[model samples]
Target: MDFSTLCVHGCSKRYDTTGSVSVPIFQSATFVHPGVGLSTGFDYSRAQNPTREYLEQTVANLEGGADAIAFSSGMAAITTLMEIFSPGDHIIATDDLYGGSHRLFSHISKKNGLTFDFVDTTDVQNIKKCIRNETRAVFIETPTNPMMHVTDIAAVSKLCRENSLLLVVDNTFLTPYFQRPLQLGADIVVHSGTKYLGGHNDTLAGFIVVSDAALAERLRFLSKTTGACLSPFDSWLLIRGIKTLAVRLERQQQTAFRIAEWLSKQDKIRKVHYPGLPSHPGYEISKKQTSGFGAMLSFETDSKETAHRILERVSIIQYAESLGGVESLITYPMLQTHADIPQQEREARGIGECLLRLSVGLEAADDLIEDLRQAIYGGKANV
Candidate 1:
C-alpha cells in the first residue's frame, strides 16, 4: 500500500464494542487470563496494551522493520537501545545531534561505563577512522538538529555491517512519511513520536523500529523490565495523529520550503540551513535520501541580541523547544534545546548563540514570512 493509504488504514480496525470507526482506547491496567493453564495475549497493561500494540505494529510496518516498541519518551527509547551494549563498549555518534541524545551519549552513558566519540559522520572516511575495536554502535541523525547536517545513512550502515556494529538512526526530523532509514540499510530506526508521529504537542512518546527480530525481542524485554512502556491513552492519541501524518506533513513541508527560501534572502540572516534550500550543503544527499524536505529549518542572525529580539517579536510562532507540531515554533538553540551542552563544545560544532531554529507549521506561507520579516526588521525600525 502507498504511504498515504497506510497513514489512515494501517493497523487500525473498527470494533463491535465501540461500534465506532476510530480504534477504541483500551485503558484497562490489566487483562484477564483465560484459565490457569491458558492466558490471553495481554496479561497486563504495562507489558502490553491493545492500543499501543496497534501503534507499534503500524510504526514497524511503516519503517519496514520486523517489530516496534513504544516508550515513555524519545530518550527512553534511546536509553533502552543503549542498554544492548555492555560496559567498556564504545559508540561513534554524529557531533551535531539532538542535545538530549548527545547528553545521554556523552554524560549519562559514561557513568554506566559506555564511552562515546563524537565525529562528523557526513565524511564517511572520518567516521570509519573513529571506529575502534570496542565500538558497538554507530549512532546517526541525518539533517541533524539545529545545524541541519545530513549524514550518509547507507554509507554508515555499510560500515557498521562490515565492522559488526549496530547502526541506529534517529528519524525524528524526517518521519517515516518522508524518510525510511531501514530501507536505507539502517539496523534500527528511532523516533520522538512527540514530534511528527504525533503531529501535535500534546503527547510525549517514543518508538523503535528494527529489522532484526532478535533485537526486537531484546527491546521488548528491556521495555517491560525497565517499565518505560507508553501509556494506553497516549498511544491511542498517537495512532490517531499518525493517521493524518501524510496530509499534515505535506502542508508543513510546503510552508517550510517557502519560509526557508524567504529567510535566505533576508539581509539580517547570516545563513539559512535547510535541506530544501538549493544552497544547503546537504541538498543533494537530502534529495537522494528523503522524499521531501522536512519542516525544520535554522538561520543565524548578526548577533545574539538580534536573534533574541526576533524571537521576542514574532507573533504567529510560539517560543518553544519541541518541533513537528501543527503550529509553528521558534527556539534559541543555545539557550533552549542545546543548553545542556557546554559553551565551548557547542561553539566547536558551529552552533552559536545567534542561531535560531524554526519548526514551520501548516500556516499561510505569506503570513509566516511576514511575521518573521517584521520580527527582524520591526525591532530595528523601532530602535
Candidate 2:
C-alpha cells in the first residue's frame, strides 16, 4: 500500500469483531486469563495493551522496522533507551538537539555513569573525530532542533557499521512520512510521536523502532520494567492522529517552504535554515536520503530585539514550544528548546538569542505569512 493509504487504513489487523473504524482502547489495567496457565496474549497494561500495541504496530509498519515500542512521552522513550548501555559506556551525540535530550545526557546520564560527547554530526567526519574506544553508539537528530542542521544519515550509518557501533537516529522532526532512518541504516529510530505521529497537540507519545528482534526484545523489557508505557486512551488518540498524518504533513511542508522563502527575503532576518532551500549546506544530502524537506524551520534575526518583537507580536501563529501539529508555533530556542545547553556552548553551536524556530502547521500559507509579517514589522507587511 502507498504511504497515504497506510496512514489512513493502517495494517489489515482488526482489533475486534465490532468492525469499528477506530482502534478500541482496552481500558483495563489487567486482563482475565482463559485458563490458569494460559493467556489471551495480553496480561497487564504495564507490559502491553491492545490499543498501544496497535499503535506500535502502525509505527513499526510506517518506519519499516521489525518492531516499535511506544512510551508515555519522548523523554521516557529516550530515558529507557539509555538503559541499554551500562556505566562507563560513552555515546557520541549531535550538539544541537531538543533541550530535554541534552539535559538527560548532561545531568542524568552522566550522574548515572554514562558519558557523552556532543559534536556537530552534520559532517560525518566530526562524528568520526569524537569516536573513542569507549564510544558504543552515535545519537543524531538530523536537521537538528533549532539549527536545522541536516546530517548525512547514510554516511554516519556506514561509519557506525565499520566501528561496531549502534547508530540511533532521532526521527522526530522528519517523521517516517518524510524520512525513514532505518532504511538509511539506522540501528534504532526514535521519535517524539507527540509531534508528527500524533498530528494534533492533544496527546503525548514516543516510540523506538528497531530492525533487530533482539534489540526490540531488549527495549520492550526495559520499557516494561520502567513502567512508562503509553496509556490505552493516549494510544488511541495517537492512532486517530496518524490517520491524517500524510495530508497534514503535506500541507504543512507546503506552507513551511512558502514561509521560509518569505523569511529569507526579510532584511531583519539574518539567515533562514531549511533543508528545502537549495542554499542550505546539507540540501543535497537531504535530497538524497529523504523524500521531503520537513515542516520545521529556524531563522536568525538581525538582532535579538527583532527576535523578541516577533515572538511577542505573533497572534495567529502561536508563540509556543513543541512542533509538528495542526497549529503553527514560534519558539525561542534560547529560552525554550536549547536553554539546557550552556550559554557559551549554545552560541558556539550557532543557537544564539536571535534565532527563532518555526513549526509550520495546517494554517493557510498566506495567513501565516501575514501573521509573521505583522509580528516582525509590527503591523506592517515589511519593514
The candidate that wins on TM-score is: 2
Question: Per-residue error at 123 for model 2, in Å?
Answer: 1.4
Assess candidate 1 and give its TM-score to the true structure. 0.97
lDDT of model number 1: 0.89
- Model 2 lDDT per residue over 1-383, tens place: 89998888776777699988878889999999999999989999999998889889999999999999999999999999999999999999998888999999999999999999888898889999988889999999997998888999999999999999999999999999999999999999999999999988888999999999999999999999999999999999998999999999889999999999999999999999999999999999999999999999999999999999999888888898899999999999999888878999989988898999999999889999998889888765532
Candidate 1: which stretches are off by over 4 Å?
Answer: 12-18, 379-383
lDDT, model 2, position 372: 88
Alpha-carbon local distance difference test for all models: 0.89, 0.92
Clashes of 2: 0
**Global CA lDDT of candidate 2, please?**
0.92
Residue range 26-48, candidate 1, lDDT tens digits: 89999888889777678898899
The top-ranked prediction according to lDDT is 2
Decoy 2 TM-score against native: 0.98
